[model samples]
Target: MSISPDSTNQRRRLPGSDAPAQAPSGRGLPRHLLGKLATTPTHPAITVGETLLLPLLAVVLGLAFAPQDPLLTQAAFPWPWLVPVVLALRYGPLAGLGGASVLLACWLGLNVGHWDVFPQLYFLGGLILVMLVGEFSSLWQARARRAETLQLYLDQRLEHLVRQHYLLRLSHDQLEQELIARPMSMRDALKELNQAGQDAHGAGPTPQQLLRVLSQFCQLECAAIHPVRDARPQAQPAAILGACDGLKADDPLVQQALRTGQLCHINQAVSAQQDTLYLVAAPLVDLAGDMYGLLVVRDMPFFALQQESLQTMQLLLCYYTDSLSMQRLAQPIVSQVADCPPRFAFELQRLAHMHRETQVPSVVVALEFRPQALKQDLPEQIMRLRRELDEVWPIEGPERQVLAVLMPLGTSGTAEGYVRRLEAWMQHRSQQSLAEAGIFTHVLPLDGAAPLRTVERLRAIAHA
Candidate 1:
């Protein structure tokens, strides 16, 4: 979905024509004109010109066919009125009236001194017809505009979903390779990032930690992270690795990434001679569309600059941005809960935000274990059964231990399924039912409440 600048500049010429096969808009002029005509013009001059041009042109053609009946009042139907009807439909009632005014002017000019012979009924009927048609046109045009706006939003949404799907698949492949070569998994790296972002002593992650994390996962050998201020990458590098050069704002890849708010690289479809100093340029933008910084890669392996590597770099940058946002969202909840894990708090706030904006439900379930169940390791068994999308925070109290599970996008049925799964697993391991094992369950749906409230409610259940 990302269009390279070079592709936009390059135009294919036709075999027999001097002009380019496609217009600069990439779509031809007819489509462009249609799009233009769909929207009402703000300039009165342009609308007036359009309204006058068509009716006058029709008058000229009518004069050639019959000079005496140029107004077409003598015809079976007032054929000349079609021009005004079309103008009204295209531009609303005002434009149609303008066109009718042109016709009226023409009629008055022809019958300058013979005003007594004016066809009152003919002009009256034409005016009434044009107005009615114009009103109908205005109504349909409004509907069409609304439909087009909705379609545009859906198209953008679909494009975003497709891009995310591609990134997810590419990241999976890159992650598998990383898992084989590196000891740290993506989750652990994100956890480290979350901790660094949540560090109260500092503002988000330090530049050095960011460079190290990128180098470890993205294989960034010579790169620099530049803080973006005033909507531009700062001149000085925030962090640099190896012999990375200073920030180049004019670099094509950097410019493209900044313009599109996406990761861009020299390997994209572009002219071979395209000028660029960096191999990759990625913006650190979160899900909320806040830009924290820009990452520029100078010296990376050619194979590593492929789609998978670029995706990994983009994914890490996004995760870093999300960590910063998550820290802010979860801070209130963490402050209230004594033993809440940073990871748990982050996911809780994230899912709560998601539910608020998207109406995608999630569940917070607290499982309390009696002292008798401590011998059975029921809490540990439940931890093992946690889904990838779920986060668990274990609360150890004086009398009992509790496992608070965060299930994202979980419905009532999903909560029941999760509890059922846990019960079955506990039975298989301990040869006893949930009640027999002295395990208690409390379910709370993440709804229209503050995240801190949700966590506080869960804490109350754990203590109860």
Candidate 2:
């Protein structure tokens, strides 16, 4: 999810305050004193140790350097007051109060025999002041801690909301692109359909991909594509395709999508099973406006089914249907290609290039045999061939086909020589297999730079 800079900034603002507070520094004595008081101990044990040690040291200092004048007793002076104030500044009111109490007790004990050493009013006044400062310091520290915690929580929530907003924006942009590039050709539709099939066969499209598209297009959730069966007497949905939140392929809403070639908006279809607010079914139609299948989406927001979203939904349905159709048609050939010796596919591609370069006749040699005939042993053989080919000639194409150097940079005679070598290689491999598999080669003569005809010829041969 992409977060807009403004939204991010807004979210990061200090909690309970619009602007961040500047750190307190020098100038005013009370502000400085307050700042000192706010510094809480990071470690509880450290605060406790300091509280224990300071009062003990104050008592020893008062005894070791006792004042002779009773009116100016050292124990009643600043030393006793300073120790507790320091404790309060460092660890807040509790530590300050505890430290002050110990210092006051020590002062009274040390001067008990000399009544003139300290005045009762002087000691009482200093103790009260120290306690007040400690309590105030603690209150300030508590407020600051609470503010910091609240700010952190607000920052996290804001980040999450921003992320979600960005994702929705990105989805909107993608939908816009699809709309602009609409009225897609049959070939493009087929290509998209093929890609979807490949994704399904491999790892399947992620929920993000499905949901983002559905939400953008305002599609119904229960739509799916099913294979036509011969003996079942009724068509069964083959795979669960795209869907919105709570709708599944088995829902009656999906059957509605299949039946109507127009947008099917059924509010409260699954309100009993789930809190379904709305459902919309759009037909997947080709450029010719021929219905191929249906797209079912459920629980979509009312605003999502606007005309623009509905149009995008129609386009998505068309694209998905075309992909499914192409996959169905290409499956047999792809299976056959997969079963063939891995090197053979590469050799065929190489042969195509050789035909173009040499302007000589070249053929795509394929071994014809049903997969069931050699199913037990073909997988191991294919795996071994794949590894060997990867080591020798690792070439990839846009179509994801394996290609080899069958007729490299060669003359007409070189082309023929390569063909004979390939034939010999096939003959040697055929001896180990007991199937109706035999090497069948189709030759095509390239005409000038135009390899289209040659390509068509090779395709025809493969089809045959």
Candidate 3:
């Protein structure tokens, strides 16, 4: 899951540009003012609090600042005029009118039974002005708030769409890399096969090894590699190779893929009246382009959007089958040689252990090489090798650690010989580069009887 440089750059820009539409209005408001506004409740309680506070403050100020004159009293009758207006703007016309009524009542109570003391016309006029202003302000504020809310919603939707688009793109890139990596695995397998072909005697992968590789590459729940038998299509069941979960060889999709030499996509299948959806099947074609058997995959949920991805995966599987065929053609030649590295020998021993334990024919092989030379002299060699290997063989583990190699399913007898050829090639290269560079080679035995502890094994090898 390495992020592309472009994606990394996009992520960097995301934090700064998030909610760009809201930026303008948000920036316009002072931080303290925005904070206070946010805390202000949307209920009428806020309006009531404002009305009570403003009038009381205004009356206190008036008593201290203004002389007790009849003219001043008349002018100051609507002393807390701003309170009702604020209440109306925040809580609507009804709230403003109610607040004004309460203030008016309070004023009348103070000047009750004293018509001469209070100018009734002036007081009435002040109350009417407050109500009018409050209502008008409230109407404008309500409209503004509605528009703002609509704009915010639109912005959110737009951002969501943009993020989805980005995720899709990211997923596409990942798929491409996975597809590209497949061929590289095949190429590595081919390299082993080619060397085996040239060596006159070597060993090669077994069917079980191939199945394990396929399972790893496809991220399958289980993989069954069956030998095509000349029996009635309906009667023969595919053989189970490497499986993460327990699945019968007689599964419908598995049987279909084996019989037809065609990829089967089982969207759903009924198992005990339970409809199970999302499955894929692919055919294994050897290097000679001969259809061997079907690669049955189950329990994977496929979406419409993942059609292209699934198709690509199928292509990779086909390529793997072809590479396996090529390796088979080269195996007899390589098997005659007994000379291989200790690591390769250890792998062979492990494969022997698995064969005895599981009663399944399997073998382990290793490709030893100097990565630095490949990187320096053949800059595109890695990519080339990746493309080739992925076509025929799926990688067992991390690509960074192992170059390209194939583990053909159901392979036996000559696996060690195939590994020996690869070892000899590495030795030749190491000797050739000894004058100018330190050349080191490491062998990894896949399908060994011991558990495939990738990190620990690689670490031990590096230290060794």
Compare the candidates by TM-score and give the number of the best one: 1
lDDT of each: 0.74, 0.46, 0.45
Candidate 2 residue lDDT tens string, 16-55 = 2232222235575665677676555588787888898888
Better of 1 and 3 by TM-score: 1
Ranking by TM-score: 1, 3, 2
Off by over 4 Å in 1: 1-25, 29-204, 215-222, 229-231, 242-246, 267-272, 299-312, 351-361, 411-414, 424-431
- lDDT for each residue of candidate 1 in 227-268, tens digit (9 for 90 to 100): 898669998888889897588788877887787776766754
C-alpha displacement of 90 in model 3, angstroms?
3.3
- Clashing residue pairs in candidate 1 are none
Weakest ten-residue segment in model 3 by summed lDDT: 387-396
How are the candidates ranked when ordered by lDDT, highest leading? 1, 2, 3
The list of candidate 2 runs beyond 4 A from truth reads: 1-39, 59-77, 115-118, 176-464
Give a tens-digit lDDT track for model 3, residues 1-464.
43233422222222112332112435564778866964548666666776667655555565677645312355635555555666666666666666666656555655568656666675566567767776787677656665554454345335434543543554466655655644334334334434543453333344455555544444455545545445222223345543334434566655555554445555323322323322655656542236665555554422321444344355445444534544454333223322222233332343344444444444333232245544554223323432211212112222222332333223534454544443454456564432133233333434444333432344344334
All candidates: CA RMSD (Å): 10.6, 27.4, 27.7
The Cα RMSD of model 2 versus the native structure comes to 27.4
